[model samples]
Target: MSSKKGGKSKFLSEDLNELLNESQFLKDSVSNKKITKRQKNDVTEEESLAKLIGQYQANSKKKKLDVNVEACKESRQKILDVMNNQLETRKEKSNNLLKNLSEVMVQLEVDCNAMKDNEKKLEHLTGAVVKCMQQATTAHRQKLKVLKDIHASFKKQCEEMEMDHKTETDKLAEELEDDIKKLQEKLISETKRSGWENLRRTIFHAMQNDF
Candidate 1:
């Protein structure tokens, strides 16, 4: 009975040793799993940081490109404004030149018209002067003709008066000579009758004395 009691005690001791060995193995496995999970979390955090750095670099490059493009646009706009101003100045100058040319042409036309009017007036004045000269010359010729006619008529009247005076003087001298011859013939006849009467009276007286 003492040997059976010793065998039972040994069996109980072996069971307890087996249970302690299994509990130690389980504790080691749980500690290994916890270390692996912590390593995976650390790797995920590093990848997230690298992605954030790459995004910051790309944003910086895009900002620089945008600034250059804006500067180029502003320069191009300034050049275009200068060109427009120059074109406007040229247009104004061309319009002024055209206006001045038109005014000059109008003045030339007026001067030409005035010259034509002056020529017409001069022609009319010349014609009037010529007509007046011709009339004066004709009047002078008529006056000369009238003076010649008056001189000729006066000479003819003087010659006729001289001839009439000579003819009257000759007729009066012939009548006086005829009257003197008639008076001499009557005186001779009266003297002869008186002598004959005296002789008769002397003879009668002588006869009486004889008786």
Candidate 2:
């Protein structure tokens, strides 16, 4: 609304300036001289009367024109005064709008700073999460290595136990074969001694072989 009023006021001011110039031109035209010479001899009364009437009409027109010019000048000044007032009001309104816009700009700056801070905080949080993930991954790797070592140790113990069992069984079998050969020689000698001795020797040989 203020802009509209300002536009109208500016146009009115321009028109008044133009009208003032026109008024000045009309005043100049009214005051300009006309070149004329009166015939002193044989000038008829009718010609004089006609000339006077013409002068009167001319004067009347000039008076009317002067009055119109004065009225136009006054009207133009009134319009100018009104335009000046409107311009002042518009200027004040424009100043107020500029102040409001400046305040809004300040608020926007603050909001922008807040957004930057939030972005910084988000970046920090992202970095922390990444660090935590890295720690977890490292810990998992260490734990996996420990578990692998434990499994390898248990497998080695099982292999050693199996080798020990095989060796012990072979040694026991050899010892049993030696004891059976000794018992067979003792029974053959007893049979030549006596019948009773032979029976005793046979029982002794059987017990030795069992051992």
The predictions' CA RMSDs to the true structure, in order, are: 91.7, 70.1
Question: Candidates' TM-scores?
Answer: 0.38, 0.32
Winning candidate number (TM-score): 1
After superposition, candidate 1 runs with Cα above 4 Å error: 1-39, 125-211
lDDT (10s digit) by residue, model 2, range 36-101: 322232145336544755565556556655665566556556655665576566556655755665
Cα lDDT tens digits, model 1, 23-94, are 345434544766666556545644764465456545654565456556655655565566556556655665
Q: lDDT, candidate 1, residue 196?
A: 28
Overlapping backbone residue pairs in candidate 2 total 0
Write down the TM-score for model 1. 0.38
Worst 10-residue lDDT window, candidate 2: 33-42
Steric clashes per prediction: 0, 0
